[model samples]
Target chain A: MIASAYAVPSVLVFVTSALLILIGALGVISVRNPVHAALCLIMTLFGVAVAFVAQSADFLAAVQIIVYAGAIVVLFLFVIMFLGVDQRAHIHFEPLVGQRAFAGVGVAITVAGLIALMARSHWVTGAVSVSSKLSNGSGNVKELGTAVFTTYLFAFEATSALLVIAVVGAVLLARRERSTTSEEAPQ
Target chain B: MNVPAAWYLVLAALLFGIGAFGLLTRRSALIMFMCIELMLNAVNLTFVTFARTLSDISGQAIVFFVMVVAAAEVTVGLGIVVSVFRRRSSTSVDELSEMKG
Candidate 1:
C-alpha cells in the first residue's frame, strides 16, 4: 500500500503528459491545417515542459515554456496568418513521384532500428545522478545561472551573437525586395 | 513512481521518428517547418532524460542553446517562407520548383 500510494501521482502525471505529447505529435503531422498544427506543436511543447518539471529540471521546464511555447510557436502562427497559407491542403497529392513511398520505408526502417538498438542494449541505463552540485540546495535557476555564467559563458555569449545575426538577416531578407520593387515601380 | 529513464528515451525516439516521417511526407512548407519543430522538441526531451539519468546540468544547459538556435532558425526560415509566398501565392514545396533544371 505504501509503495502504491507513492507511485500513484508520478505515474498519473507521466501517463497524462505522455498521452498529451503523443497526441499532439500525431496531430502535428496528420492535421491538414497549419494553424492547427501550430496549436498541436504548442501542446507538445507544454507536454515536454511538464516532463522536464517531472525530472526536476525546473530551469529547463521554464525555458521550454517560455522560449518554445511562447516565442517560436507564436512566430509560426504569425507566418501562417500573414502568408494566408492556412487554407486546407490537398493531402493526397505528392509532388515527387516516389517520395511518399520512400518516406514510408525510411520511417519504418528508422523506427525498427531504434527499437532494436534500444531493446538489445542497456545503453541508457544509469543511476540517477542528482544535480546537487549545481542546485546546491538552492533554486534550480540559480544553479543554471551560475553554470551559464561560468563554464558555459563563451557558448552563451556566442548564442547572443548568433541571434543578432539572425534578426538582421531576417529583416534584410524580408525588406530588401520591397525596397527594390518600390524603386522600380516609381521608374 | 519509478519510471525507468529508458522509457523516456524510448518515447523520445518514437517522437523523433514521427517528426521525421512528417518532414518527409508533408508537402506544405509550413507544416514541414512545424514537423521540424517537433523533431527539435523530441531532441529536447532526450537531452533532459539523459540529464536526469546522469544527474548532469550540462545536458539541460545544452537544451537552452538548442532552443536559442531553434528560435533563430524559425525567425529566418519564416521570413524566407513569407517571401516565397509573396512571390508565388502558394507555400507548397512542389510549386516552388523554379530551380528544376
Candidate 2:
C-alpha cells in the first residue's frame, strides 16, 4: 500500500505532536532571546513525549516529560538566567555570510536523502527480539526494568560511573578560582 | 488502521533536519545545545518506533541509557559553556576566535 489509512485518534495524536514539535522547533531557532528558546525547547520536548505515548512507549513518555522538559529545560533556563544574557539579541546577524542559507540547503538535502532511503529500501527490517516483546501498556515499566537489569546489566552499571565522572567534571569546570596574579584574572 | 511507521519516520527526519539546521546556523552556544537536544529527541522517537515495530524492549532500555548519557553530556557541556562565558562575557561563538587556526 502506498499509504495506509490510520485510526482517527492516532492520526490526530500524530498531527498534534508533529505540529507542536515543528512549530516549537522553529520558535527555538527563530527567537532572539535565549529564554524564549529554552521555553520553545520545553514545548518541543512535550511534543516528543506525546509522540512517545502514541507509540506505546509509555515509560519513555513519562521519562521524557520528567527528565527532558522538567529537568533539562530548567537547567537551561538556570544557565540562561544566571548568565544574565536573557536580552533579546538580533537573530539575523550571521557571522558568516549566507551561513543560514547554506545550512538550510544542507539540512534539506540530508533530510530528503534520509526519506528517500526509507522509501526505497526495506526500511527498518525487524529482527527477532532478544528481550521480551515490548510487553505493551501498563507492563512497560516492569519489562523495561528487567531488560535494563538483566540483558543490559553491565551498561546500566556503567551509567553510574559515567554520571559520577560527569558530575565531577562539571564541578571542576564551573568552579571559579580567584587568581593570585592580576594577569590570570578573567580578562 | 493506525498511523504508519513511515509517517513517524518522516516526522523524525524532519525534526532531525530542523535540529541540524539550527545547530549549523545558531551562533549562541546555549541555543546550539538546545538544538542538540532536539536532535537527540528525534533519534529517541525513531528508536521508540523501531522498538514497537520489532516488539523489542531493548530499544526502550537503550533510550533509558541515552537519556542518562544526554543528561551527563548536558551537565558537562553547560559547565564548559559557563566557564567559557566567565572568561568571555558573550555566549556567541563568533566572538571566541582565539582558537581559530
Candidate 3:
C-alpha cells in the first residue's frame, strides 16, 4: 500500500476525502439555498464513501454511494423542488441568548473530554487478524446479515416497522388535502 | 508514509466541527440538513477507520446500515421541508418559528 516517499494511496485518499468533507460542511452552512445545501451534502456523503473504501470496506463504500449519495440526496432534492420555497427570503439571525451560551459550553466540555481521552489512551497499531469463522472476506454484509437474521431478527423487524411508520407519516404530512369543513368567518 | 488512523480521526473531527458551526450559524433549513449530513459523514469515517484498524467486517456492516438509515432520513426530512415551504413560502428556519410566543 505504500508508494513514493511523499505520496501513498491511503494518505491521498484520506486527504482528499477529508478535504471534500470539510468543504462540503462549510458549503452546507454558508449556502443560502436549500437545494445547494443538499448538493453540498451529497459531496460530503461521497467523501465519506471514499474514506470507507480507503479503510478496505469496499462493500460499505458502494452501499454508502448507492444509498446516501444516490437515493437520499435525490430525495432531498425532490422535496426541495416540490416545496417551491423562496430561497431569497429575509432570515432572522438573532441568537437565542441562553441556548447559545449553553450550546457553546456543552461543545467546549465535550471537546475537552475527547482531548483528554485521546491523550490518556495508548493506541495499538498492527495488522488485525480476521476471525477464522469469517475468513472468506465476504465482508461485513454476510456477517451483518447473519447477525440480523439470527440474533437481532426482532430488532431488525422492529426497525422495519419503524421505517414503515415514518413513511406513512411522511405521506400524511406531505399530501395536500382539500378542506371539507366550512371555513370560519374572517377575523 | 501510509495514512494513519489519527489522520482520519482528525479529519472527522474537523468535519464535525464545521457541521456544528454551520448548524449554529445558518438560518436556512436546507443548510441545516446539509450540516446534519456532514455530521453523519463524520460518523461514517469513524466506522470505516475502526473496520480497517480491527480488520473486521462488522464495522463495514454498521456503515451499510447507517447508509440505509441516512437515505431514509434524508427522504423524509426533505419531504417535511418541502411541505413546510409550501405552507409558508419560506425556507429560513428563523422565520418558520410558529411556536414562538
Number of the top-ranking candidate, with lDDT as the measure: 2
Report lDDT (Cα) of residue B16, candidate 1: 89
Q: Pick out the ten consecutive residues of candidate 2 chain A with the lowest summed lDDT.
A: A177-186
Across A70-163, the per-residue lDDT of candidate 3 in tens digits comes to 7777777776676664466433345575555565566566655654565466432444644312334344556656755755566567667767
True contacts kept of each: 0.72, 0.83, 0.51
The best candidate by TM-score is 2
Q: Give per-residue CA lDDT, model 3, range B3-41, as digits (tens).
A: 767678767766776677667766777667777778777
The CA lDDT of each predicted structure is 0.82, 0.88, 0.67
Candidate 1 vs candidate 3: which has greater TM-score? 1
Q: For model 1, how does the per-residue alpha-carbon lDDT over A10-31 read when each residue is reduced to its tens digit?
A: 6677777788888999999898
True contacts kept of 1: 0.72
What level of docking quality does candidate 1 show?
medium
Decide which is better by lDDT, 1 or 2: 2
Per-residue lDDT over B1-101 for candidate 1, one digit per residue giving the tens place of the 0 to 100 score: 54667767877888888899999988889889888988998898888777766667777888889989999999899888877887777888877768742
TM-score of each: 0.90, 0.93, 0.79
Q: Where is the poorest 10-residue window by lDDT in model 3 chain B? A: B56-65
